[model samples]
Target: MSVFVASLAFGVISASVLAIASIGFTLQFAVTNVLNLAYAAVMTASAYVAYEVNQAGVVVWVSALVGAAVGATMSYLLNRVVYTPFQRRKASPITLVIVSLGMTLIIEFGTQAFVGGTNVSYTMANGPTLGVGSFVFTGAELGIVAVAVATMVAVHVLIRYTRLGKAMRAAAANRDLARVCGIRTARVVTVTWILSGAVCGLAGVVFGMNAGSFGATSTDIFVVLILAAVFLGGPGEPYGAMVGALVIGLGTEVSAAFIQPDYKDVIAFVILLVMLVARPTGLLGART
Candidate 1:
């Protein structure tokens, strides 16, 4: 029972990270209709950016914020310089997906060339351990959960109460109609990428903190879990992503505890496959 509880605790932590990344991914898809396979690449790049700042004697948390900024900038450029141009030419969705894959190879290899193939851990302490009931967490782990909660609340407010939120929803629903209705859809799409990228960057930092080390390819495999969460909650649905994250996080950790740790990712992949077959639209995704 203690072991199960411990796994559950870890699951919550993993879910927190997954939620941040998956939400960003879903938002991008919702607004831009782009299935960006390079999202993980952006995350890896942002984490490396944070690593550089941290190595320069800056605090890790502050360095993470810097990473978020870099992520926003990179995502903006990706859309403006690459994706936007292709979109203007009326590129097919599959072509865009391939392009994103190409970008993923480029970014991942570029980072590897710069950082080498060595795995590097952050130069930060986890601080004191805290226990709640049967669950134990370090200060850094608790901080991650707090950050996830705050991000979720902020996202809720952004989507529910803000003018930008409304415009984003309008654009997602019907870009042409939203444009006809005088919403600057292009601007909304740009903002979506920036906001999502910021979240993606933070998620990458937290992910490294959780694992205690990372490499250029760290986020590459993690993207599978992100996709599982996103698709399980229904692609393009932010709220669904959250639910999916919780489910997948708990499921994978608990399974890892009872089964082979090496197969944890396989568990998530199985769930994703089952979900796709059972309901391709996902739990919250509306049927067309």
Candidate 2:
């Protein structure tokens, strides 16, 4: 029972992080129609920024903000300087993907060079543990969960209530139409980059802080987590990403509890495959 409950808690925390990062990824995909493999590098990059900012007595929230700022700036610059030129040249999808892959290599190794190959941790521990049901967790877990939830809610309210959010949705759904309607799509895309970058970076930093030490490689396969959840939930569907994350997180943990702990990470792929087989659109994803 302890293991079961603990797994549940672990799963929720994992889902929270996954949800936050994947939402950003999905947003980028939705607006640009790009499958940027370099997204994970953005994660490493932002987390490293937070690491540097920590010297100034920065807390998680500030670290998150800094990480997000770096992410947003980098994302926007990449789009403007790299992606935009290539896109205007009518680059093939495969070529764009390759470019992103190249960017990934550059960012990853760059982080290793800049931040060192050594693993680094932000906060040794988060907050105090609280017993909820049969599970327990450090304050970091709770804080991360709260952050994820708040971010999601804020996103939801923005989308549902604000004119800006509606314009963003319109741009994502049909960019050509949006541009025709005077949406100033370039500006909208700029904001999307910032929002998504921040979310991804902040999530990476928080995740690293919670788990202790992490390195650039730690940011690598995590792209799979974000992609799986984002695609599973439906690309660009914020609520769907949240659901997909919870499912994947819980499934990974439960599988580990029942099967081999060593294979915990494998569970994500299994679920991804199963979901693809059942509903190619993903649980919450719309057909592109």
Candidate 3:
């Protein structure tokens, strides 16, 4: 029972990270209709940026901010330089997916070459351990959960109350119609990428912190879990992505406590497969 509880605690941490990453992934798709296989690559690059900053003796939190900024910049450039050109040419969705996959390879390998293809860890302390009954967490882990909660709240307010959020939603629903209705859809898409990229960057840093180490290829597998959460909740549905992240995070962690740890990712894959077969539209996704 104690072990179960401990696993649940770990699951919450995992879910927090997944929620951040999955929401960013879903938002990019919702606004731009881009699957962005390179999203995880962006995460990896941002983390490495943070790692460099930390090595320079900057605080980890401050380094994370720098990473987020880099992520936003990189995302904006990718959209402007790569995606926008293809979009102007009316590229097919599959073609864009292939392009993103190619970009993923380029970014991952490029970073690997630069970082020497070895595992690296942040130079930050986990701080004091805190326990509540059967649940235990370090200061850093708690901080991660707090950050996730704050991010979710901020996202809710952005989507529910802000003018930019409304415009984003409008553009996502029907870009042509929104443009006809006088919304600057291109601007909205650009802003969406920037916002989502920031979140993606933070998630990458948090993921590395939780794992204790990371490399260019580390997030490649983690991307699968993010996809599972996004699809389980519903593609392009932010709220649904959060729910899916929680489910997958908890499911994988608890299963790991009982089964082999090596199969944790397998558990996520099985859940994703089941969800796909059972309800392709996802939990909150409207049927097309």
Candidate 4:
């Protein structure tokens, strides 16, 4: 019973981080139709930024904000400079995917060159642990959960109620139709990039904090899990992403009870594979 409870608590924490990252990823696919292989690189870059900021004696929350800013800036520039030009030239989706893959390689090597092969950790003091029923989490872990919930809620509100959100939905549905309706599709795309980028950056920092130590490859490996959740939840659907994250997070953590801890990540991949074979559109995604 205690083991089950602990696993559940850890599952929630994993789900929280995965939700943030997957939401950002799916949002980009929703608005821009780009798979963005460079997303992992952006996450790593943002995590590094947070590390540097924390080293400067800044608060973790503030460092996270800076990391988010860096992500937003990097995403915006990538869209404006690389993806946009290719899009303007009417590049095929495959070509864009290939381009993004190349970009990922560059960013990964660049990061490696800059940060070297050293594993770095956040300089954080341990916080008080709080237990609810059988589940226990530290103040920091609870804070992470809170932040994830707030971010997800904010995204939901933006997409469901606001005029800009309606525009984004229309654009996602059909860019030509949205532009025909004078919805300013370009502006909507830019906003999408910024929002997704911020979420990605924030996710990266929180992930590092939770893990205790991370290196450049951390986000690269994490990106696979994020992609799995994004696809499983249904690409372009924020709510679906959250649901998928919950399942993946819980499934992986709980699997540790029966299987070797080293196989935890494999569980996510298996779930993803099953989802792909059974329902390509995802659990909540409507078939196009």
Per residue, candidate 2 scores C-alpha lDDT tens digits across 1-288 of 567777888888888888788777887788777788888898888888888787567875788788988888888888888888998999998999999999999989988887778887785455699888767777878888988898889888877899878888999889999999989888888788778777778777876776677898787878888888887888778888888888888888877778888887788888888998888998976654
For model 3, give the 10-residue run with minimal summed lDDT.
127-136
TM-score of each predicted structure versus truth? 0.97, 0.95, 0.97, 0.97
The residue-by-residue lDDT of candidate 1 on 1-288, one tens digit each, is: 478988999899999999988988999899999999999999988988898899999988998898889888889988998899999999999999999999999989999999999988778988889989867789899988888888888888999999999999999999999999999999999999999889888887878877889999988788988889999999988899999999899989999989989999899988888988888888789976
Give the root-mean-square deviation of each candidate in angstroms.
1.2, 1.6, 1.1, 1.2
Candidate 3 wrong stretches, greater than 4 Å: none
Error of 3 at 52 (Å): 0.6
In Å, residue 27's CA in model 1 sits off its true spot by 0.7
Q: Could you give candidate 4's per-residue lDDT for residues 175-207 as a string of tens digits?
A: 999999999999999999998999988988998
**How far is 279's C-alpha from truth in model 2 (Å)?**
0.9
When 2 and 3 are scored with TM-score, the better candidate is: 3
lDDT values, one for every candidate: 0.90, 0.82, 0.91, 0.90
Query: Per-residue lDDT tens digits of candidate 3, residues 1-288?
Result: 478898999899999999988988999899999999999999999999999999999988888888889888889998999999999999999999999999999999999999987899998888888988867689999988887888788888999999999999999999999999999999999999999989888888888877889999999888889999999999999999999999999999999999999998899879888987888999889976
Q: What is the lDDT of residue 131 in candidate 3?
A: 85
Question: Backbone clashes per model, in order?
Answer: 0, 5, 0, 0
Query: How many Å off is the CA of 276 in candidate 1?
Result: 3.1
The residue pairs in collision within model 2 are 68-198, 127-139, 233-284, 233-285, 234-285
Better candidate by TM-score, 3 or 4: 3
